[model samples]
Target: MADKKNRYNIRDHAATYWENSPKWRRVSMSIAFIAFFYALPFLNNPLVNTPGSDFQSVLFYPVGMYVLMAIGLNIVVGKSGLLDLGYVAFFAIGAYTMAILGTHTALNFWEILPIGIALSMVAGVLLGTPTLRLRGDYLAIVTLGFGEIVRIVAVNIEAIGGPRGIAGIPTPPDLFKAKFTILDPKPYYWVLLTFTLLVIWMVRRMAARRPGRAWDAIRQDDDVAQLMGVNTLKYKVWAFVLGAAVAGAGGVLYASQILSIVPDQFNLNVSILILACVVFGGIGNLWGVILGAALLAFTPERIRFLSQPRILVFGIALVVMMNLRPDGILPKKKREHFDPNWKSVEESGEGEIK
Candidate 1:
């Protein structure tokens, strides 16, 4: 085993620019992010401003949504050390719940958010309660199947538009005189960005507390965690539930922005892609995930002139990375004895082995 002092180092190892950023600079950067998309439409970027072009907005909105999904999934796959291949199931549940309720009834976007989130949380519990006991690849396979099952159900359900999908999801209410129309995507972008920020804040805050420690403990070794009096099952379930809530929120944003959704959108590939962001960004590292999500989401579009396969390229990148930097561009780190519960060997009366 590695030395207990060095096992989980959460120290900052960011590039000089980021590591050296002062508090004022950090705050300024955040403000820029909040206004990034909302100001894009006014900018004279031909790629997006050119008439009949919705490409840029479309590309960015989905990226924002997926970023949220990646954040949520990181809680399970990275923090809790649980491999969840069926996370898109929650995404689908949230999207469909909102789509059905918002379209059929008079429910506005704000009104539908809670219901969609609740449904997704319920779905998470339904899956987690029965499967949290499974470990390793077994849990992964079950999750993969769960995602498929949700999509299959969506395909057959006529009330939710079957294979055709639900459409004409009402746009969110207006802000003063401005509205979130299809052409004016700035408002929609801001909404997604705000949600993404909130999820990031919440996840970071949680990671500083007992819940975060419990998650890391379970991730390191469930047996040892249980021995330390951590209720492994409960914490594991909470991980799924919280992750599901985030994914559900993503779904709500996505469905509202696109104004429609089909069963095909939330598939296993989506789950794999989000997981890739987590792994590529270095699992268990929050900032790493954010950087990875942005890079992976945007690079393909930037390289479109090459006309290469995105997934194929992604697969190759993963292969190369595994052979080189498996810890990722920014691997997770933690303080020595950050959590009081994880005592040093010397403290536990187990001296160093010679």
Candidate 2:
């Protein structure tokens, strides 16, 4: 029993187990997990449903949208160790793009989708080009300003409906008889789920390659990484661009589902909430980020009976969780432990051998 307890301590040994498992077994398990999430909306479990909300609708909005945005932010904040307080700028850009084009142009949802993502990438490049050189607090402040600027610009632009925002954004064309309607949020949830899975798959693939190594090196020490020949500026811009792309995709989905949006919808608070999700979950761990976003988004709605005080409760819970797990609920394992007798070295006072 003692041995088992040690093996399954506070750290995530389960992830190690999964990593070491056979590829076929992992593939099968992944398929099963995907199936479960796809069927989640249909479950209609009263136990999991919120009292004052439509569970399906909630799943698409705060829950699904938050998870998607969190994953994107994780790339910039977690993978690259960038402090982006204005991450919501990309979200707003994408959302406004969809709203304006969908309302006035001849483009359909699929057509506008690429345009929104492209425009978001451009926005990211523009922001990173001038500000990537700044580090620490300076970088964070610039990003925060960028987020506010996007919202303020939208509010002043009458062509985009200004503060009132655009309405009548066209929904995605029907798929396999699954009609997209405000009343039935299941289709939207499925669409977002599909995109979420795709992003996860892509991120995992990237995390195993050169970009991942560059990010790790930069995160450990930017100056050292630069001395070692890593193009710090290029990679930082890449992180910003990719992260923006993800947010842009999510925004398009959100606008289509809601059929309307306002400038107030995209604010600094949204960025803070997203960053909170990344921090709450193990920052560098993908699954942990997803879990954090889901829980944080769901908890407030789950306890809606507490009314406005739910925000206070949420804040207290975050404080408590941080105190208990400073590294996050499932902090990423930095290195593998291959040597069974490694602990003996520490005990002998030799410490870790470089």
Candidate 3:
């Protein structure tokens, strides 16, 4: 009976099969999956490509960028249980950094990349230090305000082009004789893919180590974690800083690809969309979050024929999804099981307490 039950449990069976597989086989399968994504642009499948838009460009912007941002935001909202509504601020900081330096200075993309990330990290630290103490809705509100503040500041500062935004942002240097131009978005897609993979690798490693454990503890119960000497504040700050750094890198890539950026581009809606991706995908589950981001990002472009009503359709779909799976499409798996009270069972005459 137990064997039959175990065999019929698809999730358990699949998990066990993957776990028991040879390391080499697992590595090969992962490589193949990644290779498939890398070849996606070349596939040119009518079903996968958007009807009215450039498939590669769409992949680079909403698809690639959204996936990257979702992963970052997942660390905060999903792992650390932090509600950050101002996540777009870090993204804007990174984008503006690249735009300002790329236009005003002789620094190349590679050089300015670190500067953008560093500044974003600094911003994270500044915002997180005092604000990390607040929990739940309070933190979210502060972050939301922070995001708006950044945008408003950008609009008022005419030196940074204000509402007009900065233009002529130089693209990355030619890589292996392939020029990074607007006409061909494949190179940009490839670059973004490489960074996305790198971020995934790093995040996975972090999730498996002490920091990941710390986040899990914090997420489960911040008060208990602090009582257990987990230094919740430090971990919370770390999560914020790391998430900001990822956003910053994404901003740099975005600016280089578009060659122009406006304050409006990094608005509150961007943060909300990224948050929705994280929520719709599966919160702390890494692959679930990635899948969610890609699907949500691609859906609008795919259904452009619906025109203005497409948004209504999208909203309806989200509502349906939430109703069906409130936890998310690929919610994080839980290992804990409920243990029934033997005394209650005895009183109910359901079973004997052996």
Candidate 4:
């Protein structure tokens, strides 16, 4: 019982697992990380693209998609505290953008991808501008309606595949000019992983600067942030656009990977699933979101050996985890700054320091 209790302790491991690692080890870890992601798709390893190795595909590919989706949703829901529940609309926008262009036009995958991203960004701006004044539940409701509207439009419109949807979408054109197929999951995983890395880098850089602080301020208190002269609307819109672009990029990769897309694919369920990943993971923490998405996405496969009640078990585990650590699996590390007079209290770690 004690061993099990220790194993499930969240508070003790609030910091990163590798925080104590030496500099040399950290460098080595970084290099290995890059190689693993880059080589996984085409590497000849048994778990890679080998003829019989579909396990990695089944496990990691969906995890990759969810990771991208969760990371995107994090910007809006985590950073700006937007409470958006219609984010999958942007995903559909990107997928359909590629699907329509690939099937109806003579464009290649590479050419169609940019169009999809741009359209998704446009959709973000359009959605954000109208809902700028709304807050909390109002914002959530509007986003939910917007997401449904996007799906309904796709269902009713025939030119963009309609209810039956588009099919025979082509795979991406790689630099080697090699013909690719969706049946082969390696290329799709590699390409999507590359975009995911790029998005992470961009988000991290933005987070460390003024834009990051702006979003933080808005999230903490929008009226106060505005009182301090910050452009809350602009920053909120920026978050929306950024999240949409990430989702758009992921959607393009997904459409190319699946080679087929229907309106129903980007419904409310996907949005909620992505949101659950963000909430389950530490909101406002990028790595937490990634890990959360991966854990949730891959848990079903990992628990297959648990037999018939795997889903039930998974649900119970999640409920218990949240009950124990409502902040998330790993909440963002927050420091409490104290006024000069409270120095003694801060040092002693006693009294009301905050």
* Each model's lDDT: 0.79, 0.87, 0.87, 0.79
Per-candidate alpha-carbon RMSD to the true structure: 5.8, 5.3, 6.1, 6.3
CA deviation > 4 Å runs, candidate 4: 1-25, 39-53, 177-179, 304-314, 336-354
- The segments of candidate 3 whose C-alpha lies over 4 angstroms from its true place after superposition are 1-14, 336-354
Residues 1-354 of candidate 1: C-alpha lDDT, one tens digit per residue: 233434333325444566689989988987896677556546666543324335457444555666778899999999998899999999999889888988889989899999999999999999998898876577888999999999999999897799999998888889667698877777777777778778888998899998999998887667779999999999999999999999998888778878889999988988988898888887888878877776676555554555658567867877898577666667766443355555443355322110
How well is each residue in 1-354 modelled by candidate 2, as lDDT tens digits? 123234333346777688799999999998999999999888777778988988888898899999999999999999988889999999998898889898898888889889999999999999998898887567899999999999999999898898888988888889989999878999999999999999998899888998988887777667779999999989989998999999999998899899999999999999999999998987888988999999999999989979989999999999999998755776776353345553453366321111
- TM-scores across all candidates? 0.84, 0.91, 0.92, 0.84
Error of 4 at 292 (Å): 0.3
lDDT of the structure predicted as candidate 2:
0.87
Q: Write the per-residue lDDT of candidate 3 for residues 28-105, one digit (tens) a residue.
A: 999999998788888788788898888989999899999999999998988888889999999999999999999999
Task: Name the better of 2 and 4 by TM-score.
Answer: 2
Clashing pairs in 1: 8-334, 9-333, 9-334, 10-333, 10-334
Residue 76 of model 3, lDDT score: 90
Error of 2 at 320 (Å): 1.4
